[model samples]
Target: MCGADRLVKVAFSGLAPLVIEDVVVEGDLIRVRARTPEVAAACPTCGNVSSRVHGFGLRTVADLPVDERRVVVVVRVRRLVCPTRGCRQTFREQVPDVLERYQRRTGRLARVVGSVVRELAGRPGVRVLSALTICLSFNTALRCLLRLPLPPLVVPRVLGVDDFALRRRHRYATVLIDAMTRRRVDVIPSRSADAVEAWLRAHAGVEVVCRDGSGAYAEAVRRALPGAVQVADRWHIWHNLAKAAGKDVAAHSACWAKHGPPLNDGPLARTTRERWHQVHRLLDQGVGLLECARRLNLGLNTVKRYARVAEPERLVRAPKYRPTLVDPYRDHLRRRRAENPATPIPHLFEEIKTLGYSGSFNLLARYITQGRVEADRLAISPRAVARLLLTKPETLTDTQRTRFDELSTACPEMIDLTNMIRGFADLLHPRPENADRLTEWITSAREADLPHLHAFTRGLDFDRAAITAALTLPHHNGGTEGVNTKTKRIMRQMHGRAGFPLLRHRILLD
Candidate 1:
């Protein structure tokens, strides 16, 4: 090959089929002159090969970077005339590998744009491309990504499915994953049974499905793949159990008030207590929170805080010493507490309000809280009890264990509840042999007199088959959750601006 031919071959080595004829470099831009290998151009309209050149045309196309500089391909294309009679047509000769008919960018450059969009997405992808001296706009890059074909679907043997919030507590979408390969299969727009059933029906060969506690997905799987084994996620089960336990502990709120330490005479307690009284006084006088706030010259939020609580004692803060105007009334408050330690703070606040007490309700609340602390040294918080019930005993410190033991003795109902929760936890672990024990635990929970647990057991009974399979089989929705986390990351990176098509492309293709 001669010098010019050598230069042409070297310039267009990777961009096959379109051999380069000349190379020109100016500033940061490199222009390569090229032509198609074929001498006869085919008429796109008539599909007739024509060697008779009707004319010559110049087409500028963007290409991949050449030697750290942006490359622009200037192709000297030939427009040809159709030879067959009555098939009047003249079309440009085409190099399909290098450029499409109307595309401004070469096939290689388009692929580069696609890869960048896949990695960085929209605006970020444009920024990255611009930084590399390859000019691109956010819209162009997004369009390139949107035009990408979908990934080939597979018939996964083990499928994992779950729902993730698109806008949280509002719009939600479902993600399906191949559990065995840990690759996302597809993402559906809705978390409904129809959406999931449609996806399951499109693909076959799913032997087992691991999913969260969504009844919709369970129903979808049951409807679409009756032969496939459905396994409930163990994490969701424990999560539900914890929520139920917390509710059960909260239901015994009176136990906390009765046995809790005295409301401390702290600044927070005094402030809240005063606000509580002010709110109640305004409400009793048929005044709304906004009007009361204006009348008291306080923030609407402060007045609303006061209005939210039913009793002044609920405003009492944790045990802490604080100097307040009610210090002079401490002696009176102590005497009242001694006479009736269990007396509610609202009653005491009222009694003190009649004795020339000009202090706020919070001042009396702090004093009352302190008195309760001194009087009730053995008071246990229901929240603390709830934490103990949820935590494994082996993980507790000595002090925590001692406190837990005291709570169990003080509230025998807690002992029965903990035993039942433990039994349910046991059924969730690697104990396929104990699958039948779940039914027994459900029965005990229904009769345990705890409304929360009864509700939880009812849910377990409704999905008993899936729950049993979860305990028996090794499959779980772990992969589905991981995929959802990845999806969340993508959503955050895109600032949640991505529409469904772009979002799906980023997830499945990338």
Candidate 2:
């Protein structure tokens, strides 16, 4: 070891321990040329430092990641001998950089391997890490995954609750994500009322909640967050609407299928006999069209048209062409729904097709959802009914307004539903009456429900007041949903291999 003023005494410190003598760095590789500090190690039998280099070799080792640089170090090492003349096998090879025998990298490098693997949860993120650094072994990476931080704690103002299963068609778990922050608030093991209630009650600060139409979530919200406003989410509202339309379509589907083909009046009239039964009976009895229309619930014009059709159109209805296609087997869907209502659609479709249903799934789904519209219509809240009634601007025409105003003044309860519609309108344009009317309507609903309204006073049993407050504020949890989507993307990218801690760091930092 020489220096400018004099040769600086940079002798190695260990008696026989391997020491670094010189170092070089090229890309991610660090080359360290070193040897045993002393010529030999002291023998247990002779207790003397033997002046011998038993053997010497060079080994390459990986190092911890440093900034944009990935690193590996090459170390030159030597084995030392014991001084005893007849000592059996008195020497051993040395290790460098806190590594075990046969280990290709330093301990810190192993930790880094573990850190990425645990953070990402598996190989997906590991592959990304591989592209950035060295191609690490799966086992090595897996060892450090799952060192994830516990998910963050959020005091939820409102929670948008939903569920998804890793594997479809069997198990279900309710997941609660904060409607304001969009962080996953909590996850319950099942859809059970008790589990949902327990979790909801344990956490406070949920003043409002948005949920699907499930009575399960409604009951849980009532039991746990007695003061929380329970409002139906927009997605559920639209879903309910689609379901309603499907039911109407399905109910009359047979009529459509039977009459869809152009037909001669003979067998066509017989097959669609139900469609013109009133006109036929009237004609058979020589009754007039006006009387027949009322009796058969058909339009007078329809009866007249049927009466005048050509004789060829007079026979029983039959397929215009041969019945080449087979009708769908409806029994299997009935069996499936009976056996397990929760089975996913794709699975159910497969099961029914196996049982001889040749119909397209859309048609089958239409049949399955045949009566859904009626059900959805029946389930429409007074609030929704009001919205629909007021949706058209023509409804607010001067003549219409006079009628509506009279209706409102005469039936205040009905007017309250209308007020909600108007409150929603206020969201489109700023108006003072909007807020005043919203508050007034809410107060009215509360006052009307008072005698049986202990909980109502607490602002949980009824939602009008909460809806009014929300209207006044004019804000929503849309941002939260966006954040949730991003969170999912982050999880997908990481592959959930990394433990929660590192995952959190990456998510927050990245």
lDDT of 2 by residue, 448-509 (tens): 41121222223322544434444444334454345445556655664343344444444433
Tens digit per residue, CA lDDT, model 1, 1-510: 599676656756766777677788898999888876657767777787889888888889988776789989988788888888877767778888576888999887888888998878888888999887789778878888888888787878999988888788998988888988888788888999998899888887898999988889889999999998999999999998888887666554444434555534657657756777877887999998789989999999777656644566545533334456675666677687778878898887788788878888886675555554344443445556677877888999999887777665545556678898778777767577768777778778877767677778888878989889998877888888888888888888763345887888888985
TM-score of each: 0.68, 0.41
Cα displacement (angstroms), candidate 2, residue 416, comes to: 21
lDDT of 1: 0.77
Flag regions of model 1 displaced more than 4 Å. Answer: 1-13, 16-18, 36-57, 66-68, 77-97, 100-102, 168-170, 252-260, 263-384, 393-410, 446-449, 493-498
